[model samples]
Target: MATDHDIPSPCPSLRDRKKAATRAAILDHAERLFEERGYDQVTGAEIADAANISVKTLFVYFRSKEDLAFADTWLIDAVVDTLSRRPSGTSHAQAVGEVLNQALRTLNPDSGGLDAFHRGFGESEALRSRLLRMWADYEDAIATVLAREASLPAPDPAIRLAATQLIGIIRSCTSDEVREYVSGFPGEETDALRGWIRQAVEQVDNGLTRFLDRTSQSPGI
Candidate 1:
């Protein structure tokens, strides 16, 4: 006696599921090979062979070796989606903070693969540069979404600034703590990190408001 709305949608088709498995296999082999040998030492063809896919097929899944190296662009997309879905009354800073809190909850500090991924970053300058570029792209994507929410044009400076500030908190929370945890050192707990994220967001939100107010109240030039 369920309505159409109450029924679950169909799962992905078999062909689509197979494609996803193939893509995951390629990424898994690529990451393992990169971690075992440095990123510069690993070749895309070798990764394809390891994954049982042809080089051409590998290229169909990812644009370049660098794309396979990070292979976590979905993380950025998830954040942007979370922001886009925030409640109407929520501020951008609060939305970002909540999304990051959810992200921290998913971290597995004891995962050896996480440790290896962090090590891989330090072993290759190219990998580090690619990561930075990916983050910059993510900031822009988030800014575009925020602009839409505000009914402003894309690339609005204020929206972009807010996006960067919000993403900076996320980067600091993940990069610093993950590196420390992966380094076999004492690292902040998830709860503690969440507290810090909230504090940083509030500071940025209030500081910006205060600065704008002061500027507006000052004598005109």
Candidate 2:
């Protein structure tokens, strides 16, 4: 009684599954090697060797060795999705806070992903600079979403400022000091980090929310 379009496929196709499995395998092996040896000490050929794939094949999935270090590049897309699909009553600042909280849970200290990300900073200035650029990219992407959500005809200074303030909280959470504290104490320090997360959200909700409201009715703050 149902048309073919009415029933969604339960899972990805075989090729997609194989590709995902291969990508996961690469990340798993890369993280292990990066943990055992330092990031600078590792090579693309070595990562491919560990994953049982050729260097050429490794390059197919990841453009560079640094690209392999960042498996959570999806967080950018996740932010865009979260903001775009957020509940009708949610403010842009509230949606950004939700994504940040989710990110903390996703890349918790126990996962070793955060530690690797932090360690890469001390290992290479290039990597650290790239990480900062990635944060800037997040800001720009979020600003675009905020402007669109506000129904602005074009980029607005007020929207950009709000986006920057919102993203600063995310940057603070991932700062070296915070990463060390969370990764060092593990079970004990998570609550403190959560508390900071709440405070950061409150700051934006208190400060930027009002600024946005005012600017929405006018040209500038």
TM-score of each: 0.73, 0.79
Question: What clash count goes with each model?
Answer: 0, 0
What candidate 2 gets wrong by more than 4 Å, as runs, is 1-16, 88-90, 103-122, 179-187
Clashing pairs in 2: none
In the predicted model 1, the residue pairs found to clash are none
Give the alpha carbon lDDT tens digit for every residue of 103-125 in model 1. Answer: 65665654332233344534476
Best by TM-score: 2
Highest lDDT: give the candidate number. 2
Per-residue lDDT of candidate 2, residues 25-70 (tens digit): 9998888887778788888999999899999999999988887777
Model 2's C-alpha root-mean-square deviation from the true structure amounts to: 3.5
Model 1 residue runs over 4 Å out of place are 1-17, 36-38, 112-119, 174-192, 210-221
